[model samples]
Target: VGRYLVQLPRGALSAHDDALRRAGIRVRRGGAVLGAGGKASLGPLSPARRKPPSSSPRLDAITLQEQLERALRERQARPTGICPVREALHGALLEELAGTIARDEPRRGTLLRRVAGEARMTIDAYRTVYEKSLLFGASKLSEAAALKGNLEGRIAELQAETASLADEVRSLTDLCESLEHRAQRAEAQAEAETHDASALRAEGEQLQGLLDALRPG
Candidate 1:
């Protein structure tokens, strides 16, 4: 029963199998199902994946066959223009798996190449968008840096101006002290003049009394 189940259609896989089934050709092959470079559920790595450079997983016959089948499916479904562009570029990266796949599945190099080509175009389109985004970001960063420099310059100017104002304040304080000293001297001089005038009046009054006494004698 297990053997029969294993031999049953592994679930709609290939066009050839579909044609065969239509023609009453019943065959069931055991292995991973193939689709684009994604979905471990389908047993194909996500078509858009980040793998270490120079990293390729070892492939067995079953695995290679499944990978090839997936590439074929993805090729047929290639879009006219991969939208958002970034995902397209990612597809290109995953397409490198074709090279790894060919090492083990050399029998299907032609199919792998087709998959790689489609991924390449998608990636190329994405690269254009990626490059534009980088340029725009760099321009914005430059503007921010320039603004920062200007702010620093303004701060320096304000600090220098503040120092100059402080110096002016000190000078004004000294001038005020000098003016107060001069005012104190003027007040002292005025008091001395008043005392001298009173002394002169007293001396004149004593002289008048002496004159009257001499007249009476």
Candidate 2:
């Protein structure tokens, strides 16, 4: 919806005007655009009044009344080459707008008061709504923290168990090395004893032979 100076036949224009207004469009007529005795239509503005480019957070923070005041002040502050008749028409247009706003102020105030009363009636319920949202968010955070703590505890237990298993493995490794050393020593001793026994048997046979020779040769 926008402010438009669209031209149509008297009948079509009236119907179109009603429709546009219902849809929140500001339809400007030629006479209504300048002043009460202005023409049936005015020339289209250089740039159409479409939605303005998206504003920043700082601009969005400006209230509607403030924006309106700033726009009025800017227009008044600027120097223009408007002809005398056009300037007069512009002044008349401003006067008419002021009168219209003055007339509507009471109705607007009544609507505002009614709305404020309704809001007051529901304020407690709205408070509960916000409280519930906070409670849910806090609960989720609490659960996440608990889960994180449990995971950390489990990791610590696993690390401790792994360290204990590693020590047991080291002890087993040392026992195996000792057993291997003992087996090797026993094998060497058995080989040496067998060699000594063979030498002793051979000496005893030679001594027997000598005794036979000395007894009855």
Candidate 3:
């Protein structure tokens, strides 16, 4: 009379209970079942099941495995000219592997290994394609690292060039300011000289008028 608590869907529980009864194992369907010593045999079951409501949502383990394999095969079947899609597939595979590795489930390592094997197979098949399109013989990760390094270097060079150009602009701006200041001073001096010349001409006109008056009288 060993009691085993099985948590499953209502339908699944009914099926299991029927099966256990057929095997001569005692099973009771209620809120909680206790063991032989009157200790609680089963923990509290959440009313909500972990799985989706749909009985057949096409997310079975076999279907998922098949889909993953099919995707890998399709990617392998592509022509070498289709490098972008191949690279995209490779990236997707890598990301899936990372996600699988991050999962806390006991089967996470197994899933990751399966995905890694599939990715490796696809990568082997697309090696030639990558060499042709990516123009490098290295693996995708290596190529990515190299591309990143090259971009960083180019960015640094561009930044340095931008700084130099900014300095040049600042120098030009300062020079323009100095020229403007000198121009303002020259304009003020010219205005003062014109005023002095006008005063001298007026005095000479007055002297000439006096000399003419004295001569005529």
Candidate 4:
């Protein structure tokens, strides 16, 4: 017998024949059964003379075939969209296809491009923040420059005022020195007048004493 069983015809006799062939019994052209080694005739395995369990094949291919056929009929009778079997099989196949596509370089590159687009959006957001920060810094710097200019102007005014004060102080110092010299000369004149008064008083006293001596006899 061949490794693969030949397709059996659709009948009880055909099933019996296939089963016999599976069990290492071969039927010849004239309905005689021979052993697998061509030894001798076992008997004929016709459907009419076949007994129940004694002549039965180890596995009944007819019953299994009937079950498969019934299952196919039921599946065909079901609505296409609501059938669980079809959906499950389709889902499994889709999962396998997805896995295959995921491994392909072009599909992977498309996913990478999507991620890169998101990254670019994030970078743009940061750039906006950076630009606002730069504007704020520039504003602060401008204010500082304006304040410095104001301070410089105030300092110039103060320096000019200080120069005027210094000139006034110098004039006052010159006036004070002139007044001190005048006060010293006035003190010397007062001392010389006091000495002259004392000398006049002494001479008058000596003349008075001589007159009094001559008038007395």
**Model 4 Cα shift for residue 167 (angstroms):** 0.5
Task: Pick the winner on TM-score between candidates 2 and 3.
Answer: 2
Off by over 4 Å in 4: 1-122, 203-217
TM-score per candidate, in order?
Answer: 0.41, 0.39, 0.38, 0.41
Model 2 Cα lDDT, one tens digit per residue, 14-49: 655546555665545433442233224443222232
Please report how far candidate 1 places residue 190 from its true position, in Å.
1.1
* Number of residue pairs clashing in candidate 2, backbone atoms closer than 3 angstroms, sequence gap of 3 or more or interchain: 2
Q: Which residue window of length 10 is worst by lDDT in model 1?
A: 34-43
In lDDT terms, how accurate is model 2? 0.60
lDDT of each: 0.63, 0.60, 0.64, 0.61
- Cα lDDT tens digits for candidate 3, 63-165: 6567656876776746555555656665665654455445545377577777777977787677767667665545677878999999999999999999999
What lDDT is obtained when candidate 3 is compared to the true structure? 0.64
Q: Write the per-residue lDDT of candidate 1 for residues 21-44, one digit (tens) a residue.
A: 566544433433322332123224
Question: How many clashes does the backbone of model 3 have?
Answer: 0
**Backbone clashes in each candidate structure, one number apiece?**
7, 2, 0, 0
The 10-residue segment with the lowest total lDDT in model 3 = 44-53
lDDT minimum window of 10 residues, candidate 4:
47-56
lDDT of 3 at 96: 49
How big is the RMSD of model 1?
14.5
Q: After superposing candidate 1, which stretches have Cα over 4 Å from the reference?
A: 1-133, 215-217
